[model samples]
Target chain A: MGRWKNGILITYLVAIVFPFIFLFLLSMSSGWRFPDLLPEYFGFKNWGKVAGTESGIAQSFLISLVISLSVAVSSTLCGFVISRYVSYHPKKRLLTLLTYFPYILAPVVFGACLSYYFLKMGIFGTTFGVVLAQFIIAFPYALIFFSSFWNEKIKSYEDLVATLGGGSLTTFRKVLLPMARGLLMVCFFQTFLISWFEYGLTSIIGVGKVQTLTIKVFLFIKESNFYYGAMSCCMLIIPPVVMIYINKKYVFNKLI
Target chain B: MFLEVHDIEKSYNKEAIVSELNINLEKHKTLSILGRSGCGKTTMLKMIAGLTPIDQGVIKLDGVRVDEIEASKRNIVYLYQEDLLFPHLSVFENIAFGLRIKKIKDHIVDDRVIEMIENLELQGHGSKMPHQISGGQRQRVAFGRAIITNPALLLLDEPFGSLDAGTRKNMQTLFLRLAKTFNITSLFVTHDLKEAILMGDEIAYMDKGKLKIYKDRSSFINDPETGVLAETEFWKQLKTEQF
Candidate 1:
């Protein structure tokens, strides 16, 4: 039984680690054919060209960072505030049900549905347009994520603060924000991931003009440039990896 | 009267939850309100604290009309049954919360919080987090947090309900000591008949949203509606039947 468990664990670890190792090796190699076990060239030749303008992956990475950060921040803060009202509202159930509306339709269809309004607002091919589009999807997720935060106990805490002579701003700054730090970090990371990896919505709203990293990955794949595709895929996993590390090291440990 | 609640009424969906509630409590005294669950004790306390909006009533604190004021401005702290210590803060910080909110100077806050921690008999536990403390210690922290604020009135809704009997007795004694030390005016709501008689300088019984304040503890014990007679009879009958 012990051996069987060890075998399953090893297999699972290998399954998880295989893609990452393959992506790294594939990103560093070129001119490899199917019959060849390894590529003819495997070094930093492609890696060094990342900073040059030819690939533009650096610019794509930066743009993707900005869009995701904006969406994550706005959506997390708005969701935190809005979820409180929804939690205490008389029609709490109805309001909660409305948060799931964006997920009802697929992202591609949702983006397509919003294309007309995007064009009408004259924001269709802009970076701001992509941020707004991703926000539409990410915001609801954050709302649902934070809906569990407000309850009778939290309500009592708020009232307790008020009666202790703390005003609304003071109450939030002193009590609510401190209490919610861990959940807020978790929500921000989740929303950032949602915006970071969003592909279909970016393509429709950005109109091939705003080349985020995800779009660049697809573009590379479409042009049969597997090396660059693998490289961008490698880059795509970095932020989430760092975020997970920070969350584990700082947030979850303290929460536990 | 230090706290005045006049004709306060609260209703839900056209049904009255608390109707024509009235209370007059003097300064530096505790008014113990005895009522069972769903008897509008909490609603009455919330209205006085300005947490729940009253349908039609006036509440005065220190001779000033507070019904129209925000809860924060009313200077009435309401303690729940739970200790509700802020998890992110240390015991010292939890006690110091109100002072920080009022933006009191750091030195004064330090002095007062240190004094309060000692007063709460939680000297070395000041650096500990809420989860690290015992239930009795947590309740002491909650009380320290509230009393350090020096509010005009304190409303405690069965604040020691979750404690074991021994701890509850100790907390009651501690509360009386602290209340006298701080000269705190409060309305203590509890279902325990013994606790009501022990905690209150003035006692009141609530039934169906109306409160009847007793002239004295003897009167409170004599009033059958207060249920003291039945409780006494049960104790007497138990004493005779056993062994």
Candidate 2:
């Protein structure tokens, strides 16, 4: 049983590590000879190019940043606010089910179905259009994540605050917001990462015009630029990794 | 009357939760309301605090009709059973929250909170967060937070219900001491009969949305159906057995 457990652990490690090793190596490889066990050339040329202002990689990074940050901040805020009301509603289950509809469905299918609306609104091929599309997916997740936060105890706390002479604003600022602060950060990063890695929705809604990091990655692959694609993938993985590290290290989620 | 609930009514789905509930509590008096679960004790407390709306009644505080007033402006503090201290805030900060919101001076807030910490016997633990404290200490912080605001009415819903027996007893004693010191006007609701007897100056019993306030504590103790009389008799018999 011990050996079997070790075997499973090793398999899990390899499953995760191998792709990272390949991606790093591919990104660094200046040239790889055909039928060779290893690359004939190795350099940081692809990585440099991705970071350099000459390549559109930096612009794609900024675009993805704006879209992700917007989606994250807005969705989390709206979700936190709305979920409180929704949680106590008579049809909460049905409303929550509605929220899951956009997310649980295949992203490409979801995007394709909503593409006509994007065009009709003239938001297609714009940054706002892509951000809005991702928000649709991310907001529901925020709702679901925060659905259970407002229980009877929290309701009592709200009353406690109100009765202590704190109005709605103060109740939220002093009690609700502070209490859910860690979860807010979690939701922000989760939704940010969701918008960051999103390709299908951006493709369909942005009409391949709004160039986010994921779009750039696909462009790299489609153009057979494997090194740059690997470089983009590496860049794409950084934020979430940093976020997860912060979440584990710094955030205080719950005492009990 | 310091606080009055005149013909208050509430219903959910056509089932009355509190029907024509009426009570009066004089200033600086503690009323301990005893009831079983789902007996509308909590609802009545919330109604008084303006946290829950009353269907058909007026709630007056010191000659001012406050039922129409928003809960935030009511100056009534409700301490829940679970302490509900803000986990992110230190004990001092939690106690100082109401003062800070009122834009009280920094030194004044600090002085009051420090004094309260000492009074509550929580001197060194002031800087610690709510989660860092024991359950009994946390309840003390909640009490401090509510009382420091000098609320017109303090409503406690089984404030020590989550504590162990020893801690509960200690907290009850501390509460009574503080109630005397501050002369706090309060309405304490609990399911425990002994706790009700110990906590309140005037005892009231509630069942099925109706409340019966005993004019004297002895009458409340001596009431037949409330089980207190039988409980007292049992204790008397046990004393006889001991002798």
Candidate 3:
């Protein structure tokens, strides 16, 4: 049983890690021939080039970072508020159905449908437009995550706070927010990742103007610069890996 | 009467949970409500605290009708079964939450909280988080939190229900001691027949949305409808190892 369990775990680890090994090697490979299992040479030149301040890769990354963080904060807060209401509302089923709609619908299809409104609103091709577009998907995800979080226990806690002479604002700041600290951090990172790797919505709503890192990866691949594409993939992979590690080591440890 | 719950009615899905429920409790007196689960005892407690809306009734605290008052301004604390101590808060901080909410002076809050800790016999555990404490200790912290606010009426809903027998006994002793010390006016609801007798100055039994209140412990014990006399005899037998 122990051997079987270890075998299953090892196989699962390998399945997850196999892609990253290929991505890392591909990103560092400088001279590789077709039909060859290994690259002729491996070097840090691609990483060095991308790390430069002047590189478009770096610029696109900064843009992705800003957009992701903004979307994460806005979506989490808005979703949390919406979820709180939905959890207690008489029409909770209706609210929950609405919240899940965007997540169920394809992003590309949704973006296409919303593009006309974006143009009329004069937000298309701007930072606001991209962030707003990404939030459409990110917000619903957060709403669902949070809707399940406010259970009967939390309701009781809220009542306790109110009974203890805590007003709405005081209950939020002193009780709800502190209690939700770990989950909030997790939601933030999850939403950030959603926005970070989003390609379709950014492509259409951004009108090819708001170039995020995922867009950079696409551009690198289009130009047949597979190494640079792999480098972008590596850059993209690093943050999530670090975030998952942090979630495991720090944030989730605090959650019940 | 310091607290009067008059003709309170509550219903869910057109089924009455509590109908025309009336009880008047003196200042600093503990009213133990005995009922089975789903007997509307908890609903009565919630209605009094303004946590649940009363379909029709008046809840008067100090002769002031407070049913219309916002829950925050009601000054009625409800202690739940699980302790529900804020996991993020240290025991000291949890006890001081109400004072902090009232914006009491920092030094005063500290002094009162420390005194509460000593009373709870949790002096060494004050800095620890809720999960770090034992079930009994958590209840003490929760109890301390409720009374530290000097609430007008405290509603305790099976506060010691989840504890082990030994811990439950200790918590019951602690509760009696603290109730005496603080002179707290409380409505304690429990399904446990023995616990009802143990906790209340006066006991009320609920069945099918109606209340049958006993004016004194002797009356409660002797009431044929309550079956308390038989239960008492059984307890006596168990104590004498007659079972």
Candidate 4:
């Protein structure tokens, strides 16, 4: 049994980590060529080019950060309210189903639909439009995570708070908010990651002007700047790593 | 009349659950609802607490119609079987939840929670999380959570059902003593006839969604029509460890 478990663990490790190892090697390589077991030479040259030069990658990084943070906050807050309301009203399942329609659509197809609407509204290439698109795409994830958590804890606590003469706002602030803190944190991180790494919607809606790290990475790949693209990919991995570390250190232990 | 539940009815899936239920509760009294599972006892309690909606009829508190009032504004605290103490909060913080909801001053919240901790003999346990405490301690914390804000009505749904027999008896005693001490009106729901007789000032027998009130404990125990005698016989047989 132990050996079987170790075998399963190794399979998961290979499945998840092998791509990163290949990408790291590719990023460090001096040249892109086939028929070589390894790159002839490796250096910090790619990292230097991306970080030192006036590459738009840095700006893209910052833009992605802002957009992701905004999307995470707005989606989580709105989704929290919608999910809680649905939980209170058993008859609102149809409304909940309607809210999830965007999430069920193909990302590219949904992006096309949203781009059409944004174009008609004259905000197609704006940062606000991009943020709005990301928010809609990520809202269902937040709703699902928070709704499950709310279904477990909020109903009983709401009853308890109500019995104590707390109004709606008071119940939300005092009971629901505190009880939901952990799940909210989870939703925040999840939504932020989703928005940060989103490529298809951002590319389509932002129309190349409202660039993000993902857009920069894809652009570098298109330009055949393999080293710079790999470096951008590496940079793209940092925020999620930092987020997971912080979550493990601060949020995980207190969540229960 | 501190609470008047008038003609309250609820149904699920087009089937009647509670039909035109009416009851009057005064201050500092114990009303125990004895019923089988799925008999709408819990539904009635939730309706009174405004946690569940009434399909028809009205609930009034102090002669003020409260049917449309939100559950939070009803001032009806409910204790569940699972204790439902906030796992993330310490015993003191768990008890302070109701007071905090009422936006009581921080220092007073501290004082009252501490007072409850002492009164309930939960002194050293105040700093511990819900999971760190015993079942009895958790139940006491739940009771403290409900009573801290001095709610106009307290609803208990088999609050001691999860405890061991010894702990259940101790909790019953503690509950009665605390209820009397605070002069708080309470409605308790239990399947155990012995529990009803021990804790209830007035016993309500409910079966098949209909409620019949008995005069008092002895009358309830002796009356064959109320099914109390049969239930008591079952309890006695179970206590004697006879099949």
Best by TM-score: 1
Give model 3's TM-score versus the native structure: 0.89
**Residues B1-243, model 3: lDDT tens digits:** 999888889999999999979899999999998888988988888888888899998999999999999899988898899888888889999999999999999999999999999999997998898879887888899999999999888999998889999999998899899999999999989888889999999999899889988877888778876778888788899989964
For model 4, how does the per-residue alpha-carbon lDDT over A1-256 read when each residue is reduced to its tens digit?
Answer: 9999999999999999998887787777777667877677798766666655477777888899999999999999998888877766767678667777887788878999878789999889999989999988899878777667656455777666667677778767766777778878888999999999998999899999998999998998998978778878888999999999989887898774
Per model, state how many residue pairs clash.
0, 0, 0, 2
Q: Write the per-residue lDDT of candidate 1 for residues B1-243, one digit (tens) a residue.
A: 888888888899998889888888899999999999999999999988889988998998889999999998888899999999998899999999999988999999999999999899998999999989999999999999999999889999999999999999999999999999999999999999999999999999998888989989999999999999999999999999995
Model 2 Cα lDDT, one tens digit per residue, A48-70: 77767765888898899899999
Off by over 4 Å in 3: A1-55, A253-256, B232-243
Q: TM-scores of all models?
A: 0.97, 0.92, 0.89, 0.86
Candidate 3, clashing residue pairs?
A: none
Cα lDDT tens digits, model 1, A118-173, are: 99999999999999999999999999999999999999899888889888878788
DockQ of 1: 0.88
Interface RMSD of each: 0.8, 0.9, 0.7, 1.9
What's the distance in Å from true for residue A164, model 3? 1.0
Q: What residue pairs are clashing in model 1?
A: none
lDDT of 4 by residue, B1-243 (tens): 888887878888989999869888887898998888898888888888888888988788888898898887777788888888876688988888777766789999998888999989898998898889998999999998888888888999989989999999999999988998899899999988789878888898887777777776777778786677786687899989965
* Ten residues in sequence with the least summed lDDT for candidate 2 chain B: B218-227
**lDDT tens digits by residue: candidate 3, A9-110:** 999999999988888889999668888878877888778888676447888888899999999999999888779999999899998898878866689889
- Please give the distance, in angstroms, between residue A145's alpha carbon in candidate 2 and its true position after superposition: 0.9
Write one digit per residue (lDDT tens) for candidate 2, span B1-243: 998889999898899998878889999999999999998988888888888888898999988999999888888888889888888788999999999999999999999999999989998999998878899999999999999999899999988888999999999999999998888999999989989999998999998988888999888877886779898789999999999
By lDDT, the best candidate is 1
- Provide the overall lDDT of each model, using Cα atoms, as 2-decimal numbers: 0.94, 0.89, 0.89, 0.84
